[model samples]
Target: MNRKKSIAHKLLDAIGLFEIHKLIAKHINQHHADIVVDYDLSLLRSAHLIGAPKIGFFHFRPKRFRNGGTNKLRRIGERLKHYQKLVVLCDEMYEEACFVWPHLKDKLLVLPNPVDLDSLLKKSACSIDFPENLTPGEYFVSVARLTHQKNIHLLLRSFAKARELGCKWSLAIIGDGEDRVDLLDLSKKLGLEEAVYFLGYQTNPHPYLAKAGGFVMSSREEGFPVSLLEGMALGCPIISLACPTGPTDILQNGKLGKLISFTEDNPDELGLAMFEISNNAALRKNYAEESKLFSQNFSSQKIAHQLMSLLRDIASNQRP
Candidate 1:
């Protein structure tokens, strides 16, 4: 039966993964590693056999943790025992993880994603074949793959609504993905052909970020978005949906920029925000200044130092 074949395939995968973990453990032992840092959940199993302390760096929001469903939480809890530390991208994720697995409290740590502010500033100064209609400090910009998760459709809908509300600023999206065709169709359907420009994937988006009047994020979910940070580094005012795990922490609870609730289904919320930012120069300038100043805290040097300090303490057998 098909069910039997599926089970057999899963069994093979489990065996293969176990062998890989054993090999990894052997390599760690041979190298006399001080600590092992893994990015995938599957690799945590290798920590059981490895003598060195292990740290798990999780990048995305786990469905189990998000929904608080008991289905796979127990399995995830079991995996946590193998690692001395677990690094999550945001404080919200840390709180959720501890809530779901209270016993793993001591193991959890919050480390937001870092950006090279110095290098990013340099790149932002580079010139590009700027769009004819798009003027600096007069348009909103977003950098994300054209996908359902990104909720670019929501962005287009909101842009249309903003136009109806008499907002004159245009929107320029810089990214490409599988959802491109569908999104383009939706853009046309929404009558945003003239106002909304799809620039596709750019090798260097920093220049666009620097020139943007505002940066917006409409994702349904994110794991400490680096694009938002890059926008802040470029001194762009921000407007982001208060999605899971990232925007709230980065925006410092809306002090740095506009943070909208994702639960509000009406397009008017985002539309009104876009309209307000576009019309108010003083507000934009204040938000831009705050954004740039707050962004320094997330520079690569500071984050690197914090990470090294944690690793050093853990390796030296001291709790951090």
Candidate 2:
């Protein structure tokens, strides 16, 4: 799923998917299922075989609809016509989808990811060994994979610039990925060896999120990031890049948090955001309160009710 496959590999994957679909279809028929929901949109061809109304959900920004060649996008649009409805994570994506396939505008739905606020709050209270050098409410924290998409390198560069600008807070990154070594190298190259701590992946990142001075997201793209919502639920002041698809919606165009944009060669805007958040206590408190209040709108119960209503309508052969 990461890259293009050889023709032989593609053929094998297609055969395997067909078998899986057949088994799934048989199970649905035996169980008298009223609807079929595909999270990956791979079941489009198998919808008729399953003999049930089908819904497709995709979480990430689909690269095909954006940058993929014209022929591939046409094929994707054709495949999408089989679904009773398609759910995307944010309004920006909904607009993009409608623009790409105006014919299926009525079939598109915007549904942000839900966060279990109560559970996250409870988890944030659990006792864990925190770093001794970093004070709870004085260090910036980020929880994301160290990947090109997450853009940890930009964070490191921004942290460096913030440090030069007299921002005293250290940064704690709480995830791991293939780009770990490169990110670490960049951190050292920027002379942040002592100021930036790579805590790697944590089974429970909520404690860190709950106690940090600020939560920062530097992703290049996102589909309604759950981590951002978790940070909000934990009442951390937020600083996120105006990335594709999600951050703008989550931050409410910078009302709920500090939103910054950056170019490939310049991360000064992000640096200034970090510096401002570090220096201004009133700003942090205001953003934290607003973020906590806004996060309640995305609670599990509320979003679940909306989803259940949609499923019930679809199940009853009604358009939603």
Candidate 3:
């Protein structure tokens, strides 16, 4: 029944896409718009149907196999081909798209997501009704939707293992989603009800990241984990799964922080990584220093200009 509801929800979401895009198209027609900068991939078809020149920002990367990403590409092939240029968040994802749809090779461009460092860091200092037990520099933190894709289950279970191995680190995950109950149950099952804290969705999660001893991301997949970069900006040392399209570029292939392939990773391995990050002061300091350096690339002043320039160029071509 839950699965049926999930399918229905997705179907409704797809329908909503058409409805919303039609409205957007209607607005464009009303306003005499020149081009549509499409941010959501699901809306590409609508953007095309709207009869405006379309520039899509592609951020998702499904696993690349005949039955996987290829099939997804085929479903949207009509709208996909019509994009004036497909803006991807990173070079790696851009490369993957080019390989799948060679026809859109020239249309692909890499423009990573920008972060508001100053604003986020300020939020990191925000006074919130925090869990009283939480102490600055004593607990590891993560910010992700409580979902299978984000893999908080893996992080919880791994933290449990690390606990048994004599590490006394507490974990705080900030984000609310479908998997929260299941994760809480798992924490209880692992006897981590006390050690692990779920703060649910937070509007300003930076202060938690800023005060945290370190940050851990155990995601199974990602387009580009913006939360990972946010952690870096807040000076939180990190340990993350080397998922698609984000970590390598931001973490600089582990020069800035810990990155490993998590699908093949075991509880003990992840636990060990967590324990190491929590236990070592020197190592944490080094990663934090390197993280500060790496975060500058994603600063708002930087990527905002890149995106703006891309829009300017796209608009210029249509001029005259």
> What is every candidate's alpha-carbon RMSD to the true fold?
2.5, 2.6, 4.0
Residue-level lDDT tens digits of model 2 in 1-320:
71256878788888988898888778777876677779777676567677667788877675544456768777788878878989998887887778777888899998778998889989999998998998888999999988888888888998899999999999999999999999888987899988998999999999999999999999888777889889988889999998887888889999989988745446799999999999999999999898899999899999999999999989777434
Ranking by lDDT: 1, 2, 3
TM-score between candidate 2 and the true structure: 0.92
What's the distance in Å from true for residue 30, model 1? 1.0
TM-score of each: 0.94, 0.92, 0.86
Error of 2 at 128 (Å): 1.1
* Model 3 residue 243 distance off true place after TM-score fit, in angstroms: 1.7
User: In candidate 2, residue 42 scores what lDDT?
Assistant: 66
lDDT of 3: 0.81
Steric overlap count per candidate? 0, 0, 2
**What are the Cα lDDT values of the candidates?**
0.86, 0.86, 0.81
Q: Ten-residue segment with the worst summed lDDT in candidate 3?
A: 62-71
**Residue 315 accuracy (lDDT) in model 3:** 87
Model 3 residue 121 distance off true place after TM-score fit, in angstroms:
1.6
lDDT of 2 at 136: 84
Ordered from best to worst TM-score, the candidate numbers read 1, 2, 3
Candidate 1 wrong stretches, greater than 4 Å: 1-5, 62-69, 318-320
